[model samples]
Target: MDLGKSQRVTRSEIDHILTNRRWSLFDVSVLPSFDTGSDHRLIRASISLNKKNFERDTHRPAPHKIPTFKSADLEPAIESNTWTLFEDLTEDYDHLVGAPLKCADASRHSQPTTIPTLNDRAFAFLEKRKAVKLDPNAKHLEKVITG
Candidate 1:
């Protein structure tokens, strides 16, 4: 690895490639001819990433509306009391988020279906778009999408 000796630089073998054990390595070589205005030569490696991350779903997620902060009602509530207000808020929040998630048992036969999600609405819009694209009838596109 006498890389930089031709350019009057000190000869050193400091350049090395750190790789994962899961990846399959084919070759690792130094390209000494390709100068990059530096003493160190270009270290090249050919390897295949054998990661499970590559097998994941690559589909774009459906967009949904995010709830904005409502500070008008909450402003005066903070002034009344801190501890009691927080406790009441926590109770209300729990009832809002935790009600539909109750587990099934002997008394409860099965869990209730969740409220219609924004994801479903977005997918419906996507289906309408696909329908409009496939069907060439411009005049009846609205009818096709809706019906």
Candidate 2:
């Protein structure tokens, strides 16, 4: 064992003996000529032990509660007596539904012309029906008119 170039050190047989049964030495090395300000040379060893002997915390925190609302809670406002039906409200029907005849007067230089095509009238009627069907307030208006 070359302990160092300047100083030599030795270990006894009793120093090499293992005291504990759980601990086992894996490696042993001698560090020489490293200036640590001490005359004695440094020796290092790797050891292994069983980790299953230790205890650990496995508990988890509880989940938080959140508030939610149902459609039934909103039904009172929809069915209220004060709710105004959209059809009962005053609105210019001819102006709201686009009349091609009305556009003839809008131009000063052009002569007033009427839409003679039955196909154009049918298309306008279909468009108005689709608009009424898609309107959310139209349901309440229909209920007031029919009943």
Candidate 3:
């Protein structure tokens, strides 16, 4: 018997096919034929065994939890102010020089003579520096970024 898109097959159609068989429907899938501008269409059906039966009969045991660790039973670590070689040097230099100096000019001065501690001075130097923009061919999705 042919089945159309609007037609619904009853449960008897399934029972008739599995009359002598002992299989249970674990899953059912149907695939429809791709349209090539044709009136005739084809469908495929697949059936598999139920997964619950195999899982129920398995001998695998669940994991057990250990209670060795308790939040109240643990001790906290002790903190110390012991100074290392690098820490001592860094603190001493911070007190003396305050910050690292950068060269203002490449042709006139090879190295900066003074260190700048202020953020405004560092930002001013960066603002005066030249920067490259994005490539012309680069695609930007945002409307504001397109320009």
**Model 2 C-alpha lDDT per residue in residues 1-147, reported as the tens digit of each score:** 334446566533222335344345667765563543345565567766545532222334444433233445334433442333356335445433433233322322432254345787787876777777777788877645533
Off by over 4 Å in 2: 1-18, 51-147
Ranking by lDDT: 1, 2, 3
Error of 1 at 140 (Å): 14
Clashes of 3: 0
Q: Could you estimate the TM-score for every candidate? A: 0.25, 0.20, 0.17
Clashing pairs in 2: none
Q: Candidate 3, after superposition: displacement of residue 21 in Å? A: 21
Output the better candidate (1/3) by lDDT. Answer: 1
Off by over 4 Å in 1: 1-26, 30-45, 53-69, 82-147
In TM-score terms, candidate 2 sits at 0.20
Better of 1 and 2 by TM-score: 1
- Candidate 1 whole-model C-alpha lDDT, 0 to 1: 0.55
Cα miss at 107, model 2 (Å)?
99
Lowest summed lDDT across 10 adjacent residues in model 2 is found at 99-108
Whole-model lDDT per candidate: 0.55, 0.48, 0.38
Ranking by TM-score: 1, 2, 3
